[model samples]
Target: MTGMEPLAPLATAGRRIETAIIGGGQAGLAEAYWLRRAGRECVVFEARKRVGDQWRERYDSLRLFTPAWADGLPGMTFPAPRSSWPTAREVADYLEGYADMIGGSLWAGVRVDSVEMLGDGSFVISTTSGQWHAQNVVVATGSDAAPKIPEVASQLDPGIRQLHSSQYRNPAQLLPGPVLVVGASQSGADLALEAAQAGHETWLSGRHPGELPVNERIAGPFFWFAQNYVLTLKTPIGQKLRPVIRHGGSPLIRTKRADLDRAGVHRTPARTTASIDGRPTLDDGTVLDVANVLWCTGYLPSYAFIHPAVIGPDGYPTETQGVAADVPGLFYLGLVFQRGFYSHLLGGVGRDAKFIAQLISERALSRNTVAA
Candidate 1:
């Protein structure tokens, strides 16, 4: 079958393929595009029933920080005004459409369970549907694999409603009293502003990570160029800034601290360290008695499905520019700083995908030649 054709249904037994990509998000879809261009046989397995369900699962009020011009994948341009910031649903629909346009082997609702490298260097992937033996495996799962909630959350009174940012859709999900939003990063600030606007007494705990120095609209092209090319792993400045960006909260993009202040969001530049008498207490000994606690604390990378040896001590894959160092034919995509600062971003991920796809294609071609 041609590369554009849908992958055939697998038998009860293991199905062997040239390449298997895990996660059908932007990264996986980008890789699929390039692989298809190279005439490679591959399959993209996504856990959700439909492509872009991940984006659709986000909060109702969520809008991308980047403009439409910067959100396109590999071949297709985002179908919106260049300056418009697309909503979560818009991005989701765009992704679904991109998948349809690519016309490759995409299997939805199939969750990958495990990825184990055998003695022969081939990977045996266990999935919800069946097993597959792949010569090359690309782990394109993005950074936000699992929601990260502080352990102190368990100590809060069960009477108070608690919702992680991932589970938060609208202010309606909150209790009818004061709302305490923990973590003042992009997500936290957005949620706090929403709660305050919805007429709730909002307390935003955590320091602001600062904002872009200039207006994004005017500096759009320059900023995009810097992020896409300049602030990369290859440069000394980018290397120095990598750890800081990875550990620190992401700087506010669309929402500024002044906006939150105008909305009357009480800003607390301290962490919520404890729960005292069923109330959240700040590190400075201030107690907040709130009916709803929203956690915008962000997420943690989960590599439990992959072999432990391939993962680093920091709980991420040990790879160089998406290629796994420990295992041949094993690669990663959509990782933060995988190639550069924008490696995980939609417009930037395609670059990394193309690089990995080229390597995979070259290796496949070499194998074929040796066999001949």
Candidate 2:
């Protein structure tokens, strides 16, 4: 009725389980679902105060790129119409309902501080609430854990308002003047279009990742083809294209080039290459004097809380399709390209989670037999 209903707290001190899933978003919830079917005891630790706060915390103008029918986790289908493009609030509500329906082991308001592997091939999770010893640890914290803003931001004048896309809630959150949105990713394009629509002189800068044939609106037979075929990494061509898309960023799926043109949003070079006299400078030597700047440059994967040995020098966990190699009981979920192209998407996380659940179950069976 008011704020989110707080999750009943668990006794955090010395809790032990078969698995510990971090970050109670789609990835963690999906893991919990299949683990329950396997009768594996697991717990989810969410940093947010509420169940669906992750999606709810994003920008105000956000909507799911995928159709509602394709956005569900393992067993729970999203309740909206199949063709509908759900709002961020709808997604948030759906996640909350999903959590409630599953009734799995979850601890909200608990921030995972550190995860360490013991010599006995087990993991110890340290959190704001308490400690947990888990036989297996699944890092489902997702790709958006840390916002990546360039160091050049410090060079800008203090008079020009600047914030990462994560911090942006709406156009009203920005100062009244020309708005500069850096990064041509979906978030950047959508925000730029929104700013322009709101009467702000908006400039969008970044390398175009290209646009999808269909968006949330005016989707037809092409929508099904794009969703079920082209975007999936299971195909040979899709596999070959994964690296390019991953490094370049996802193509504009929701906001199209025509939308930007209609909104009168100006385009610039791929990045803010430099700063001149407290103004934003692009790669092509274009200097923009804007009052507000939104950095949609994307997020850095933050696994700092995890031990260095668990992660590669590239800042990713040494995992093959969610199962870590060097660490006996360490696993990862919700990462970009974890297994397939859709791995990070809401619809795709469940498949990866199910696979990981099978691995966890096999290991458990082997251990029990040996002990017997």
Which prediction has the highest lDDT against the true structure? 1
Model 1 alpha-carbon drift over 4 Å, by segment: 1-13, 219-222
Poorest 10 consecutive residues of model 1 by lDDT? 1-10
Give the whole-model CA lDDT for all candidates, comma-separated: 0.87, 0.82
Q: What lDDT is obtained when candidate 2 is compared to the true structure? A: 0.82
Residue-pair clashes per candidate? 0, 1
Per-residue lDDT of model 1, residues 11-92, tens digit only: 4537789999999999999999999888788889999999999988899999876788998997899999999888999989
User: Which pairs of residues have clashing backbones in candidate 2?
Assistant: 206-270
What's the CA error at residue 126 for candidate 1, in Å? 0.9
| Model 2, span 1-372: residue lDDT tens | 222233334555587788999989999999988887777888888999898898888998788777887788878889999978778888888888888877756888899999988888888889897788999998999878788998889999999999898899998888989999999888999999999999999999988888768645655335445544675666776677656655556677778889999999998655798999989998888999999999998887888898734666646677777878777778899878776667887877898899999999999999999999
